[model samples]
Target: MTKRQQLEMDRGQDGSDSVHPLHNVSSDRSLTVYPRGDGQLVVETETLGHLTPRRTHGTDEGRTDAKLPDRPSVHGLSPDLLVPQPATLEPLDQHIRSHTGYPDIIYQATLIPPANFAMVAPFVYRSSFPLKKNFPFLLKLGIKSILTLILEDYPVQNVKFLRENGIRLFQFGVPGNKEPFVDIPQDMIAAALATLLDRRNHPILIHCNKGKHRTGCLVGCLRRLQHWSLTAIFEEYRTFSAPKSRHMDQQFIELFNMAHVGPLIDTNHLPPWPTLL
Candidate 1:
C-alpha cells in the first residue's frame, strides 16, 4: 500500500472509526502542512474563539470586550496618508531670501535649451546637436528637415528616430574646429542654401556642434540673400553667438555674395522671416 493508505489505516485503528483523528478540532481552527512532501509537518492553529479572551459573567459584568483593531482598507484610504507630501516651490522661494548660494533655476533632464538656438527664416532654424531628446520640441515647431554640419559620424539611433518621424536630414560634413578657424566651404554653403530655398524642405534646422560658427555663417548668407544690411546680419549673429564668437565668422559672412550662389528671391516676396527673428 502507498504511504497515504498506511496513514489512513493507522488513523482508523480505533474500530470506532466513525470519528476522524482531527474531528474533535474546533470549527474556527485549521491544520496546515508546511515545507510540504517527505519531511512535511502539520501545524494546528486555534483561530477566533481560542485567540479572543472569553469573559466570565460575574467579574466582567461592566468590562468591554477587548479585540484587535480592524485593518484599514487600502481601496478607500487617501494617498496622502500613505506617502509623505513633496516639498512645495513656495518654500524654496521663501528660503531663497536667506540662502545666498541657492540656485534660482533648477536643471531638468531633456529640458535643457538647444545650444545657440535661433530661427533664421520662417522655415529655417539653427542650433547645435539637435539631440533626440529635443526631437519633441522640434516636432512642436513643425520642423520637417535637418541640415547638419558636423564632421563626425551621425548617431544611428537619431537617424532611425528621424526616419520613423518622417524628418529628412541634409548633411554637409565640415572638418576641424573654431579655435583653428577652419573656413566654411563654398560648395557646402551652396548646397545648404539650395536645400533651404526649396519650399519642400521648409521648416528645416541647420546645426553644427555649437551652432555658433558654421550655422551662423549659413544664416548670415541667407540674410545676404534677403538683402539684409551687413550690420543687421552681424548683429543677429552676435546675439546668438556671444563672448567666444569668432571674428573670422563675421568676415566670412561679410564677404559672402549671394549673386554667385544662384538666382535670388526678393525678401518681401519670400515667406516671412522666422517668428523667433
Candidate 2:
C-alpha cells in the first residue's frame, strides 16, 4: 500500500493519527513508529510535558537533594496494606485502673442522706478508709472527724494523714462479721450517736473495711435518730450493702432503741450536707 494510504488507515476515528500496529501508545506521551525492511516497527516515546527537578535547602550545606514522601507499593493504595499491625486498644480493667489506680476497690461511695437532702441536714459522709491515694478526695470534703467501725487498729499512715490534716478520729469497734445472731452493742451505738450529735464534729465520715455492714448499722441508727422510717433506713442500708447485705445488721438496726442515744442535733439546725465537686 502507498505510505499516504497506510497513514490514513492507521489514523483513529477521532482524527488523531495512531502509530504503527507494533508500537504502543501511552496516556500522557506521544508515540512514533518507523517501518524497517524486516517489517517490524521501531517505536520511540516522547513525554508530553517538560518536568523541572525540584530543589531542596539544607541547614549545613548550601544545597540538598530533593526529598520525596514515601509512596505505597500499589499507587493510591494505603502503606499498611497486608501489614499485620498490633492493636492499640486498651483493656477494660486497664482503662478503669488508669483512673482509679486501684482495680480491686470498685465499690461506690457517697455522702449519707445523699446531697438531695435539704440543706439543713447534717454534713455526714461515709466511705472506705481514705487509703493513701484517696486521702486527697476525702481531704477536699473538709472532714473534721472520722468514725471507724472497724474492729482492727487503724492504719498508722491513715491516722497520721488524718492528724496532719487536722481530722480527729473516733473508733468504736464492732465485730466485722456476718453472723446472723451477732448484734451491735447498744452502748457503742449510743456513744457513736452522741459523737455524731455533737456539732463539734459536724462533718464526719463513718467507715468500715468495705463501708457496708458496720457502717450501715451505725448510719441506720443515725437514720432512726432522724425519725426515718424502718423501710427507708433498710432500703438505704441494702443499697450500700447490696448482694451481700447482712440480715443480722438489719435486725440490729430494727431492734436498736433510739431512746438509748437520747436527743441528737435537731434536724432543723443541722449544717448543710457536703457534696463531691
Which candidate tops lDDT? 1
Error of 2 at 33 (Å): 44
Error of 2 at 57 (Å): 28
The list of candidate 2 runs beyond 4 A from truth reads 1-121, 263-277
TM-score of each: 0.54, 0.53
227-255 in candidate 1: lDDT tens per residue? 78899999988887787677888887887
- Model 1: lDDT to the true structure: 0.65
lDDT of 2 by residue, 236-266 (tens): 9888888899888888898987676655335
Q: Residue-pair clashes per candidate, as listed?
A: 2, 0
CA lDDT of every candidate: 0.65, 0.63
